[model samples]
Target: MMMVGKPVYGIAKSRSAFAQAMKSQAPQQTLDDLFAAVARQVPEFGGMFLGDNEETLQVYLSVVSPTKVVAVQKAIVAVFGTSVIPKGGVKALQGQYGFLQLKDWYDRMTGPILRVSGVTFTDIAEGRNHLAIGIGKPEVESRVIEQLQKLAIPRESVVIEVSGPIETLTHTVRMPNSMSPWPYLRAGGYILTRLLCNQTGVGISQATLGFNIIGPSLGAGFVTASHATAAWWKLDTIAGFPPADFYQASGYYPPHLVGRETVDPHGFTGGACPTGLICRYSDSAFVRYNSNVKFGVGHIARTTGITTSVTSPILTIDHGGSPSGEFLIVAAPSVPYLTGLTLNKVGHYTGWTQGKIQMTNANFSQIPSAYIQVGCPGGLADPTMPPAGATLLSQYVVGDPTNDVVHSGDSGSPVFRSLKGLALRRAELYGIVWARFAGTYKQFIFSPIGGVPFQPTGVKTDLPPFRYCDASASPPC
Candidate 1:
């Protein structure tokens, strides 16, 4: 959770003042901490939202049984002075739940059932009351439903989705690196920016570097689809071959594929883990920035040759690169996961596109072996699944029925909150783009940065630069 300053008692001395602060949106972290504190104090905390006037922070507690709603409000008032209207009783609290708490309960209850063959992924709904499970094979739906019934999940709150067959989503045929012919050379090294191409020369298809991130232990590292590196790692380790390089356009000859290193998949011998060199999760990989190679950070491109920087918490409204000159400020991790929000991604094939988050806490098991072996390498699987604990979420953008929200080369693009008008310095990194539904518009599967398990072998720090967006959005300063 994002750390918040001490609540100001004087400012909220009056309920009207408190409402005014909320109206300003008062920074997402402030609101998040308030809700988190209340939920933590009361296990039965259900859900919270702004009242019709948009000033009152309305809270609801579980009405499974009678609740002291007024007493709870008084207690909260004594501490924060924030205006709240507590609603109780079964009727009022129907379908309400504490998202984090309920998700934890579901995870605890369904561990064994998750390992079933057809169970691809599972996640608590954004609303906290609903649960969704991705079923790979339709035939196993009955058994899954029976298992859930035994576990006591309400039938109406559960949604079973079909995510297609058991095949791995890895696209193995490598494409030509798509750098411009006349690449810019800076400071005696090839300086590449957005749209400069990259790849592992093996059978894997070429992909574009999405953006770069900075952390304490490392320099800027390029980010991309995890499958690109995973596919190469298998070949690199078993066949003793080298991975591909990042490239700028070479004027005379074919663009030189500069020698790039494989950080995650870090090689199959060591399944991808969070290292200063490479952090892999969400079907995405981070490649250490080699000063010798000289690649710049930030700057994403659209199909129309326009570009924007990722350094700020912002997103351009137009997808085709025709600059709308309008940018949507990003929200912090305090408000990390939400459905029905617009999201954007940049990739080697599909330049840029937008979509909405269809679900949260999505579960997936039928993934490439690389993810299964994460943080363990040659050892037995880690037992923890790729997205099981808060590390991932899924989204589907219904485009014009022609363009995909994301494509194979687009993996590793950051999925961020857009158009909320929240204030911030740079684009908030929400989750890493990984896989997509085959033959459908469900183009991206994302892993939240917060829930990733850092292996003891790599850089021991949380994901860098954006670590604040991790588990609770509050990282040690």
Candidate 2:
């Protein structure tokens, strides 16, 4: 929960920082001097807030110096979403504070043109002006009028507009003292980026946009990796560019778990969503993550049978594999209530990462397609939706078995069904990933749709079978 570049502080600590900022040089220092003093309080990342002090008072006045007006305006805008009236800032002049009439308040907020909000220019002359301000996160119009009312000038000169309960607040509420709240800060969310990446089948997230060029047609998708977890930028650069990159987007859905909560006594976990099935209904695109993608050339290490058990929780890729990593998935079986199973969702590199398993059992009948989708997290190869107990090999045209074993960027990855190895069926060598290639290896890569070229020669690194199947999650043989 740590903010990338912000200090952790309680209200009291923050107040201390502000007070410390006030102790510098002289009370009547220049605006630049004021900013510098407040900056010292931050001590790190330029402590982006400020407080009221004699120097702050002086600097506040100096803001009228024209050079500092815009600076003040910018800061004020950040906190309340707009600047104060021309009559002056908090230091300019103070006489009265109250609820001004709505029409006058509205006028001040909207201006004669009735356009921009949360900004004002008040030059009160006489009488009492009662203006009631709105509550938190007020409308732009209300924000501006609220500042003017805080001046507390006489009632005759001002009136105000309140959107809801008409809470009677003093014109001048405590401003950020510094710009803690600004419009620019709440611009993006991590989950959205992650979803966009996965849904589009691309390999990049939205958090990394600053580092990557997000032109149109680049699409929105990303591939995941345990290798380059935190240091993903290197991979990003290597993949060229992934549009709309975002970072450290973390989220999880417990309802999606299997056997534990939603499952029945017989071992059937009711229907659930597949982790990696991108629908054509979505306007998604593809992406590339360089090192982030491990050319998962490995296998499962343990033995498994289709059975329901609570004595022990299933170990995911954590099961014993080999001296090197290989593909060994937890095969699932068809049951009335349970449609899917879960895995450890982590990497345990043990075997040779790139060896073939000539399926000694070779039986995929009782396996449910639901489990297969889970194996590929957010991916499902239903192609034309076959009936129950149908083996996937029956669904596709097999190409080269030797070449099908591994490919580039497929490292530390698992090709599975039911979120495990048993359901995983390596694509026929040179088979299509269902994605098309717009460009060629010889030329620049075009995005959106492109062909998945066959595993080129030489790029292949020979290794033994690393797969280890969990005897626990596999179907009853």
Candidate 3:
């Protein structure tokens, strides 16, 4: 979890005032220390969040015993001092189970629950202090409940909702003309690859380039969705198959060779995964760009004219290499994973959009055969039984009821939150858009940058020059 200052609730009349208020609050370390003290003192501590009023620190407890509540209150007082404990006092609420317990139950019950037909996703709802299971069909709710009962999981500790199917957001055809012909490549720009699937013939695939990164040994590269590459299913199967080449703007044309896939770990069973479940931390792939291509670190393409058709133009509003039109990534701080925190994303197809985080640490189910056929065709044989599917862990789910937050060709888009007080046109990097729920325009999912496997030592930015120090080098260069 990221360190945060005092919670800001409701609408802020002035960004400067909001920043000043955050600056005046007690250091984030104090809250962290208080949380640690409470966790050590109260074993039933469920979780913590900012109260609706913004001043109170709302703590949840499984049992909510008088002694535990008093201990938590005392800890808060000791940390913040009785006289200056914000405006609203700390409050302890009754919860069904502790956060850790709910996480454990989530790991244990995901396979069984997903085995039931029509199940879509599962999440550890830290804010609500319960486990949530999503199903596509309402009739399967009883079966899901029965599965939970069989595992001895309390019904009250879990919530089942109809969420429909989850599908990847990679588009098979060329996207609208939002491509940037700028001298440098940047985040939120377009990337393309050609695929010749055995099942589906030749086609061009498009997805958003996530961000620019650099490592001590890997040099400079960018990240994107693994499934958007050509012959992705053969990554782990075929030997000596050529690495897929990526293009920008135009396909099979000059000045289009940008990079090639380098690091993409295939899914596997066992080793930290629950029994019978295939596991992977991210649906991301790292691409090492060519030396000739200039990469603009922290720069996100400013786009406009959003449309759902292939013929319509989605124009890149910024031109002539001006920084004013782009969103500058000031920091890549860890997210607090709090529900209702507003986040924004810039995709090649969707342009820029905003939504609130609905769930954190969400796990989405993928049928084993379908997953392998699409991204790992020549791997292990298909399983004949249920509960033997793939589960993607540690994902953020965002939704906006009034608008479509994501769409086809938006995979690998940069997901972030604006930092209004820090600077104009500045934001913090959070995650990368990967998939969206089918039949719904509101819900989409992203993989947190911190959890992305093989991520760079640090995210590169334009303002501050990023330096990579190798611990193994002589004199720790």
All-Cα superposition RMSD per candidate: 10.7, 29.0, 8.8
Q: Candidate 3's error at 127, in angstroms? A: 2.9
| Cα-based lDDT at residue 260, candidate 2 | 8
Rank candidates, lDDT, best first: 3, 1, 2
Return the top candidate by TM-score: 3
For model 2, state the Cα shift of residue 271 in Å.
37
Residue 168 deviation, candidate 3, in Å?
0.7
lDDT of 3 at 371: 38
The digit string of per-residue lDDT tens for model 3 on 187-257 reads 45555544433223444566788776665555677777766654332242243334566766534443566
Which candidate has the highest lDDT of all? 3
State model 1's lDDT. Answer: 0.40
By summed lDDT, the worst window of 10 consecutive residues in model 1 runs over 1-10
Error of 3 at 54 (Å): 7.4
Q: Which is the better candidate, 1 or 2, if ranked by lDDT?
A: 1
Each model's TM-score, in the order given? 0.58, 0.17, 0.72
Error of 2 at 43 (Å): 85
